[model samples]
Target chain A: MIEDRPLIYKYLRHDKKFPHVWCGGCGIGILLGSLIRAIDHLGYTKDEVVLVSGIGCSGRLPVYVDFNTLHTTHGRALTFATGVKLAKPELKVIIIMGDGDATAIGGNHFIHAARRNLDLTAIIVNNNIYGMTGGQYSPTTPYGQRATTAVYGSVEHSFNIAQLAVCAGAVFAARGTVYHVRQLDGLIEKALLKNGFSVVEVISQCHTHYGRLNKLGNQIDMMKQQRDSAVPVEKARKMSPEEMEGKFEIGILVDREAPNYLEQYNKVRQKAKNALSLQLTKEEKEESERREALDKQ
Target chain B: MHRRKKPEPKAQLMQGNEACAEGALIAGCRFFAGYPITPASEIAEHLSYRLPQVDGTFIQMEDEIASMGAVIGGSLAGVKSMTATSGPGFSLMQENLGFACMAEVPCVVVNVMRGGPSTGLPTNPSQGDVMQARWGTHGDHPIIVLSPSSVMECFTLTVKAFNYSEKYRTPVIFLMDEVVAHMREKVVLPEPNEVTVIDRVKPSVPPEWYLPYEDTSFGVPPMGIFGEGYRYHVTGLVHDIRGFPTLRQDEIEPFLLRLFRKISIHFADIQLVESFHTEDADLVIVAYGCTFRSAHRAMVEARARGLKVGLLKLITIWPFPRRVVEPLTRAKKTLLVPEMNMGQISREVKRVNQGMTTVLTVNKIDGTMITPQEILEKIEEEKK
Candidate 1:
C-alpha cells in the first residue's frame, strides 16, 4: 500500500500514554480521525506540520499524531502556536483543543489570535464537558446539564461556537459533530488550506462523563441529540431561533480572505531593512570601533 | 610588556542599558519586544532608540509573557531577538521560558534582577533570582543561565546570550542586577563586522524532508521559515525527534531523557568562571554577580594581611560549576559564600561540601551589597 494514502477509519497507533482517562466511546477519537483525514487530504508531510495544544481532554491532541507537538499550559496553545507561525510562516501550524481549553481558559488568546488573522488553523474538539479532569462543567456545557461544578442544572447559557468565532474576527469558522464526522473532516481540510485563523468546532460525544452526569440519556441517545440539534447556517437564517434550537449547523460558518499575521508583520521588517543598510555602512563601522576602544580603557 | 596601542576615542557616553541594546543590534538582533519596568526600563528605552537605527522592530507588548513570546517567535523567523525586564516582569515570563525550553526555540531574556518576591524594591539591588533563573519554571529541565557582574559584562553577555540562544536552541538568561542595569559604564561596542553573529539553524534538506524538530548534524534541528515551503509541525509535546506530538511509551521516555541530557552532556562547555587567589589558600570564599565585587576586595585584603584566601566568582550559574566549587570546598579548610540575597549560593556551596570541609554562608537580604568588611569578618572568624 502507498504510504501516502491514509486508510480511513483505521485505528490511530501513535500516541502511547494517550486517549488517557477519557470515558469509553469518547468523541475525541472521532475528532482525531477527522483531523488525520484532513491532513491526509492536504498531503501535509507529517514533519512539516506543527500541532500545538493546551491542557484539557481536547488539548491533549498533540500527543496522538506525530507532528511537532507542544503541550503547554491551559489556554496557552494559541499563544505558543502564534510563536510557531510567526517564527516559521512556511510551517503548517494547527492548534487542537477542547471547549473549556479554548473558549474558557483560552478565550482571550482565541479572540486576539482571530483579530490578528494569524496563519494557523484551530480545530476545537469541543466535547462540552471537561472530560480529562472528572466531568466538570465547562463554558460550553449546555444551560441545563449537570456537571461536577454545576451539580444542579447549569444556569449559564452556552456560547454559540460559530457565532463566537465570527465575533472574534475569525476568517474561517464552522461547526461539525461526531455524527457528521466525514463532513467534519472535509471542513478541517478546507480550514487547513485557508490562510488566517480557521476554526472548526466539532461537537463531540462525552458518553462516560458528560452523558452520564447530565442524564442526557445513553451514548446512542446523545449521538441522536447532536444529529438532530444542528440546523444549517443558511437554513437557520431563514428559521427562527426556536426552530434552530435543536438543530445542528453542519458546514462553513465564516469563510473569507484576509491578510495573515506574518505577512503583515513582515511589512515592519521590510521597513527596517533600509535602516539596517544605513547603520552598517563602512563609515559607521570605523566610528563604532574607535568608540569601543575608549570604553574598554 | 607589549607596546601600547594608541587610545581610540569614546564616541558617546551610553548607559549600560544603551550598550546592551546596541550590542544586541551589532549581534544581528532584528526583533526586540519588551514592557517598561523599573531598572530595566532603560533597556526598552534604549532599544526603542537603537532598533530603528538598524531597521529592527521594537514592540512594547502588553506584558512580559507576550514580549518574551514575540522574541521566541522572532527568533524562529530567523531573526536575532531579545526582551529585557526586572524581577517582577521576569516572574511573568517564567511560563514562556518553559515553552522555549520544551520547543527548543532560541531567544534571549535579559532579567535585571531587583530585590523581592512580589514587586519588592524595584529600584534596589538584590540577587534574589539567582536560583529562580535555574529553577523558576516548573519541571526538571536543564537550563543554561549566564550572570553579568559588571555593566560591560551586561553588554557582552547580552550578545553572548543571543549567540548561545541561537547555538543551543535554548533561552539564554542575562541575569543582571539593578545596579548593573542602571549603571553607566563606558561600553565600547565592536563594529558589526568585528563581532561574529550566529543565526538559527535553517533546514538544509528540501522542505519535504525537513522536520523543524529533526536535529541537523548540530544536535539541534534546523528551523524552517514559517511562510516558506517547509511544512513541519512544532509542538511542546514530548515528541519523537521528528517534531510531532506523540504518546508512545517509547516516545515519552526517550523524549524526556533527551530533553534533559542534551545540555547535560555538554555542561563543561557551558560553564564559565573567574577565579583568583585560589592557590595555597587556607580559606576560600565563593560568590557571583554583584557580590563578586565585594568578594574581590575581601580576597585582596585577606591576602595583604598575610592570610591565604581567594574568590571563585561564577559567571555561568546554571550547570552550577559544582566541579569548580567541589574541589575548592574539599581542599580549603574553610569556605564562605557571600551574596546580596539570603544564602542562596551558600546553600549550593554546602551541598557540594559533603562534610569534607566546613562550608559557611554570609547572607545580606537588606537590599544592600555585602561589603568587603563583612566577608573579611567571616574569614577572620574562620581563622580562629
Candidate 2:
C-alpha cells in the first residue's frame, strides 16, 4: 500500500504475506515481476484474469497476485485451467509450473492439453532441479548433471519444453531466460494474447539446489551462463549443428492459428441445435398430417 | 434456430445410467468431464451428446484424475459440474477427490460400483466401494455419498445429490452399482417445475469485502464466482478464512472444524433413509444400492410365510445415518444385512448397534449380486 511504488505493485497482494517464499535472488521472483508487467501492459482487468499454478516454488506465485488465483495439485495446473477457460471463455487464464510439475507427474495432461488446443497460457519454469523439496533431479535437468538423487550425475536426457509444446500442437511456443527480462516479458505477453494453446519455457536458476550441487556458483553465475549459451532461434538455425551443440535456442519457435476448444464447441452447439430443430419440425409435420387425415375420415 | 423448450415425456423405459444424465441436466449441471469406463461410460456418452443440445459443455478428458480436476475447475468458475467413472477410474480420482474436499468445491462424482481390488469385475456389480466412497480419499474430510437401487431413484437421487453438494459446498458421491446402472425400468420424469433444484448461495457482500471462507452462524460461507470481480485465492492446502494457505494452528484448526461441523450440524437434512413395514416387525433387513431390491423381495417372501420382516433402504450412505439405524437396533430383535461385499456397511451397523441386537450378515463376493433367496435363507436361519 505504499505510494510511489512501481505500477506492477498494483497487481500484488498489499494486505499481508509481503515477502515471497522463493529463495533470495531466485529466478522465479524475477519471472513474477516480468509476468506482472506483461499482464499490466496487456490492460486486462484484474477480475478478468485467473492465475493458476502447480506445486513447486512457482506454485506460490498465485497467492501473491491480486487476480483470481488457484493453486492446484502437483502437475495439474493446465487441466484446471482448461476447465476454467471452457466454462468462462472470456477470462484470460495463465498457468505457472516448474519443470517437474509440468513434465513429470502431470506430463499426460500437458501433452493432451496442447493437443486439444485450448486457449490457455502455460508458463513453465525450468530450474533443472526440484527446488521446493530439496535438490532432486527434474525432467528438465541437463544430462550428466549432479542432483541429490543423481550423486553420480543424471543418465536421462532433458526435455526441451518449447519444442515439446510445438510438437504437441500448441499454436504458440517460445523460450526465454531470466537474463533476458525484456524478451521474457514480450514472450509472455504474446502467449497471453494467443488464441490457441500457448507455452513459454523459462530457463531459470535454482542456485540453492541444482547450482550448489553442480558447482554452478551463485545466481549471478548461472544467469551469466544463460546469457552466454542461449542462442536466438534465427541465429541458431544458421549456425552448424556441431557449433551449437551445447547451446539452447531462445525466441518464438512456433506461431500459427487454429480454432481453440471454445470456438469449436460453439459450432458444435449450433450444429446440435440445428439437428434438434430439424427433428422437432419433422415430428410436428407428421403429427399435423395424421390429424388432417383423421379429420377427412 | 431458437425454439421453445419442451418437457420430456412423462413416462419412459430408461436405463439407470441414462436416467442419471437426465437427472444432472434437470438439476442445473452444465459442465461434465469424464473418461470412458465400463458401466459408467454410458453416463458420459449420453451427456456428450445431450449437453451440446442444451448449450452445456462436455469434455472427455485423458484420465479420471484430469476429469475430476476439470470438474473442480468448472465448479470453481461458477458452473455445476460432474464426472462419472467405475472402480479402477475411481481409484485414480482419489487424490483429486481429496483436493475437492479441501478446496470445498461443489461437484458430483458418480462411481458406478464394479467389483475391484484392481479391475476385478468391470461388467459385474459389487458394493465393495461402499467403504472407499466414504473414506477413499486419504483425509478426515467430510463427504456425502448417495446410492440408487432403481432407475427412478437413479434420477431422483442424482437430483438430490446436486442439491446437497450445492448446499454444502462439498463433493457428493453418487454411488450406483452395475446392476442398477444397466437395469431398464419405467420412470415418470417430473415436469420442469416439479423437481426442486438448489444453487449455491452467491456472496451478497461487495467484492472487496468478500471473504471466501468466512465463518458464519451456519459454518457455510457464501461462494464467489471466479472472473466476476471477487478476486480470491483457492488452494488444496489448509487455508484461513480469507482462502489463503495458512500454517498457523489457530487458522488451521478452525478451518477443519468448520468443514466437519457444517455437515455434522445438518445430519438430519443430509441423511435419507427409506423405511418399509418397520413399525410392527421384529426383524429388519438393512440394504442399499441394487441389493436393496433383493432385501425388499426377501422381506415380502418372509412375510408371506408368517415371519414379521421389514426393510430399511439407505439412500444416503455416508455419515452412516446412525440415528435411523440405531433406533431399529433397539426395536428389532434381529437385523439381517445382505450386500455384495463381505461386510462394509454391516460393520457400521455393528458399531452403532453396540451388541444391542443380533446383526447377521449375508456376504457375497463372486462378482454376482446377492439373491433374495439367500437373504430369505438368512432370515429363516435366524428364526431356526
Candidate 3:
C-alpha cells in the first residue's frame, strides 16, 4: 500500500490538538486546508508565521497550526495583529475571524485595519451565520435567510464583504469559496505576499446550524450551492446587472498598492529623528547668531 | 578649539502626563496605542511626539478597546507596550484587559480618572475608577494597580507599573486622577540606572520542551514571545500549561489559582505604602492618589497643633496593601479616608478594618478636590 499523506501536514501540530473543534464535513476544514497549503507553498518558516484569530469556530484554527498562534477575544484579532505587525514588521501575521466576529462585533476594527493598510493578511471566514452560537443571524447572512434568531427569515440585507474591504482601503481584496479549493489556495497565497492589508473572504458553510435552520439540505448540498452560485470576477464584470442577482464574485475584486502603515511610520520616525538633530538649545542659538555676525564683519 | 560647556542637570516644570510619557520611554516601552480622551489625551499626544524620535511605534487606535488589544499584541511580540485612557474609555477597555489577564500578556494600562458613570465630567478630577480597576474586568484575575500622588511619583510610578507588568506576566493598572494627570510641578526625573527596569523571563528550555504556562516554583512562568521559534499558542480561554485551551478540571483549577498566587506570594515587594508621622499617633488618615497630597498637608498642620495625627498614603491600590493597612486598623483609633469619589477605596479600607477601628470617610462627588482644611476639620472633630 502507498502512503497518501498531504504536503500540508508539515504545517500541522501532529503531536497534539487532533480532532479539531470544527464539525465533520464543515467548510472550515476545507478553508484551513487551503490556508495550510498556501503557507506551505510560500515556503515561509513556521517561526516567521503568526496566526491570530478571534473567538469563534474560525478562531480555533490557529491552535492546530504549528506557528506562533494567538487566539484573542471575539472580533479583536485584527487589532492584535496590528500591534504584532507594527512591533515586528518581519513577522507575517495572518488574522482569521468568523462572519459575525468580523462584521458585527469587530466591524470597527475590520474597517479600521483596512484603512490603516498595515502589512497583515486577514482571512475572514464568511460562514453567513454564527455557527458556534447555535446558528444565530450574522451581518453576512442573506436577507430572507432563516436563522436561529431569525426564524421567520432575516429582514436586514447582508454585506458584500469583498466590496466593503475595497471601499475600506485594503490594498488587495478577494473572495473565494470552500468549494473552490484551488482558487482559495491561490487567493490566500497571493494575499500573503501582498504589500499592504490584504483580505481573502472565504465563503464557507456551517452545515450543522446554518444548513439545518435554513433547510439547505446537508453539507455536500451547501458545497454544491457555493459552486453553483459563485461567479468569476471576469464573468461578473461582463454580466448585466439583471443577470448578477444572488451571485458574488469568486476571485480578486481589488488589487492595488498604497503606502502601508509600517512604511509610513518609518518615514515619521526618520522625520522625528531629523527634527531632533536639527534642534538647538538657547545657548547654541545665541552663539550661532553671534558667529554669523562676526563672519559678516 | 572651543568646546561648549555641558548642560547642567536641572529640575524642569513638567505636567503629570508629560512625566508619564517620559517615564514609559525610560522604562523601555517601545510601543504605545491609545485613543484621545480628556486629561489622559496629553499622555498619548506627548508619546506620539516622543516615541517616533526614539524609534518606537505609537498608534492612535479607533477606541480604547482596540488600543488595549494592540497594547497586548505588542507586548506578546516582545516589546513593552502601553495605553492610556480616562473613565469612559477605561470602561471600554475592561473586556480586553480581562483578555490580557487570562492570557497573561504583560502590558500597562493607565486610567486617568475623570468623573463618570457615563462621561459625567471630562476635565474634572475624580478618584472614581479605583474599584473599577480592580473588578472592571470580568472573571477573577490578579491585577497590580499603582496610584501616584504627585508629578514626580507619576513619572516614577509609571516606570514601576511597567516593571510590575513585565515581572509578573500580568497587566498593571496605572491609576491617576485628572488632577495628577494635569497638574504641573517641578520634577527632576532619575537616570535610567537609578530605577530598576524589569523584563519578562524567557524559557531556558528548547521549543520542544517549553510550556508557556507551566506551574513553576515561582508562580510566574517564563513568557515566550511570538516569532521567537517557540511557536507556542496563546488564548484568552482557560488554558493548560501548554497554552492550549483545555476543558479538564485538573488543569483549570490550578490555572486560575496561579493567576492570583503569582501576585499574592510576592506581596512583600508589591505592597507600597508611604507613611507620614504614623508612630505615636492616635488618629491616622488613609489616602491615595491626589487625596494623599491633601491628607499629607492635614497631617503636618495637625502635628504642628499638637494633635497626634498620621497619614498612610497607599501607592499600591490593588492587593490593597492589607499587611500594612490591617495593622493601622487595629493600632490606630481612627482611619480617615478623604477622596474625590463616593467612598470607593474607603470601602476597602472599611472591609479590612473589620470593625476594629472608626473608619471615617469624606467623599466629594461634586467634581472637586478634597481640601486639606476639610480633612483637618474632620480630624479636629475626631479629637473632640
- Report the number of the highest-lDDT candidate: 2
Q: Candidate 2: misplaced stretches above 4 Å?
A: A1-5, A286-297, B1-9
lDDT of each: 0.77, 0.92, 0.92
State how far residue B119 of model 1 sits from its true place (Å): 2.6
Judging by TM-score against the true structure, name the best candidate.
2
Q: Can you give the DockQ of every candidate in the order shown?
A: 0.22, 0.56, 0.61
Residue-level lDDT of model 2, residues B1-384, one tens digit each, is 334334356588999999999999999999999999998999999999889999899999999999999999999999999999999999999998999899899999999999988989989999999999999999798999999999999999999999999999999999999999999999998976999999999898988899999998887889899988789999999998888888999999999999999999999999999999988888999999999999999999999999999899999999899999999988756788898998999999999999899999999999998999999988898888
**Candidate 3 clash figure, as a count:** 0
Can you tell me the CAPRI class of model 2? medium
Which scores higher on DockQ, 1 or 3?
3
Q: Write candidate 3's Cα lDDT for A211-290 as tens digits.
A: 99888989999999999999999999999888888888999999998998898999999999988877746558977777
> What ranges in model 1 sit over 4 Å off?
A1-49, A60-71, A155-157, A180-195, A234-260, A274-297, B1-12, B23-36, B41-82, B99-105, B166-169, B196-260, B298-309, B356-360, B372-384
Model 2 clash number:
0
lDDT of 1 at B178: 76
